[model samples]
Target: MSGGVDSAVAAARAAEAGHDVTGVHLALSANPQSFRTGARGCCTVEDSRDARRAADVIGIPFYVWDLADRFRQDVVEDFVAEYAAGRTPNPCLRCNEKIKFAALLDKALALGFDAVCTGHYARILTRADGSRELHRSADMAKDQSYVLGVLDERQLAHAMFPLGDTDTTKADIRAEAERRGLAVAAKPDSHDICFIADGDTQGFLAKRLGQAEGAIVDETGARVGTHTGAYGFTIGQRKGLRIGTPAPDGKPRYVLDISPVDNTVTVGPAQALDVTELTAIRPRWCGAEPAGPATYTAQTRAHGDDVPVTAELRDGELRVTFTAPVRGIAPGQAVVLYDGTRVVGSATIAGTDRTGRPVTV
Candidate 1:
């Protein structure tokens, strides 16, 4: 249940609906102290305990399964390596795809559970033909279908999200948890990345990849400044650059691109961030192939506004052309496609012109 109010409420709702529900918390860390820094939730002994307490309150059994090794290999290592290759990776999406849906779903099926349920803010709808489709949650502000869109048809068939139908805000969830006397009722939402414990991505990379200095160049290939490491910066970054020189027009500069091969960070005006097209690789279709030459809305990041775009499947890739140029379309981020309220599918953004070229690890 992740020891969160949303999952706690979801479990209670499932149990109230007469489903035989058992709460399973994936213990994804070997060291207790390293995983529990009070900055982020999940993967700690205390979180498991809180989940068990919630399960007890709901009258269901709970178990903590050790998935530390798999989590490290699948999510942690991949996150570090993606950054090393000069790409901004979304580890949360990887956790949902590899750990939650793939690993946990298999374990749940082996334990003879009818279906797995999570507090994810997304919906699963069954078609008349007995197929499954993913949809946006009723709570638009909390809709997480962007990350959960990576699930295939099989995974969707055996998944349930009780919060999909409820228009409960975060305040409502906290109130419900408090009303039920749950311990995590008033716990502040976890902000930092879960495994890092400390929210210093650059520090983590520096510790892992030693001290490698590189040049920070402008868009015209002029060396503007020097960075300790190319992995420390990301697209759209503006602060912590330590650049002493001010623009001729006295305006601020933003990160335009990062070139790992040349070991350079490119800086330019904000307009340089505009990108009209993006290509996504390893696309996952939600249900059926979308109708030919479909027009839909897409989001490149969680909580990002959905922009109008035209999507077409070409040679195993989805090429998207945005109606209006968007900014900061980074590689290794997910591009989720939506047709109104229905989630069509999602794919990893491989590269964009504004971001230079794709770096594969």
Candidate 2:
């Protein structure tokens, strides 16, 4: 339970089904001041209290589990490291794969719990052939299976999401919460980065990686500007570059890449950001690898528009070729594939292949 209406309702539903459910609200941080600054915080003491209150109203046992140490190491530190390495990382996916499904589920099993349940908007389906598959929520706009794509078959087997069956709107969920008299029925959704209390992701990283002044270069290797650090920018960033180098063609510039090793930022025309091919590592399949090379739809970021692509799994890596050029794909961000609404697989992008054909690798 994240001290939110969804989890509370999930717990209520589970209990209504005659299961001895325990509400476990993960205490993801050791900071005491972490509380509701609206509906956007989960690390606050107030959240735990709210979870406990909901557990009482639902007539179930509730406990706050401190996973702060692991969260810092896995999600927080890894985020800074990815940025320092000039790769955009999604901490939420990391938390789901490592902290929630791996750590929390393992703990739940050890305690004799049959399965771990959450309020995530995703679904697990048992195909007619007895294979379990992860599918998108009925509401595509609010679907979150994209982030949960990191889980493999084993993890999916032990997980449960009660909100995936119907295309229930957020307002409907809130109304259900209100009918149940949940205190958090009206809680606002959490916004911004959770760990960065001040909401400055760059400053939070800079405090850890510190500052290293570097030169900003154009695609021609010509120094155009300078920044305190290269990690502050991402691929395809067009604003706050604080650079004065105007293009000869009089077109606005966009960030093409960030080289953290040499501490340089590369700015170029927007077209230079287009990538026709992507080479990614750390491939994770919901089940086993595909029988062979397959054509599917893929998204570089969770909120990106899914486009048709040819994905090939070879030598333990995933190589994707887009039918049309895609922009802003960055190393270290997940490239999630889908066969319609069902999640195909996910891989952490390592590089791009601009000249590759949209064929099997």
> Best candidate, TM-score-wise?
1
TM per candidate = 0.95, 0.95
Q: Which stretches in model 1 have alpha-carbon errors above 4 Å? A: 354-361
Q: Model 2, 241-298: lDDT tens per residue?
A: 9988689999989988788888988898887778898888898999888877889999
Give every collision pair in model 1.
none
How many Å off is the CA of 102 in candidate 2?
0.5
In candidate 1, how many clashes are counted? 0
Q: Summarize candidate 1's per-residue lDDT along 32-82 as a digit string, tens digits.
A: 668745527576777777889999998898888888999999999999888
Candidate 1 lDDT: 0.83
What is the lDDT of every predicted structure here?
A: 0.83, 0.85
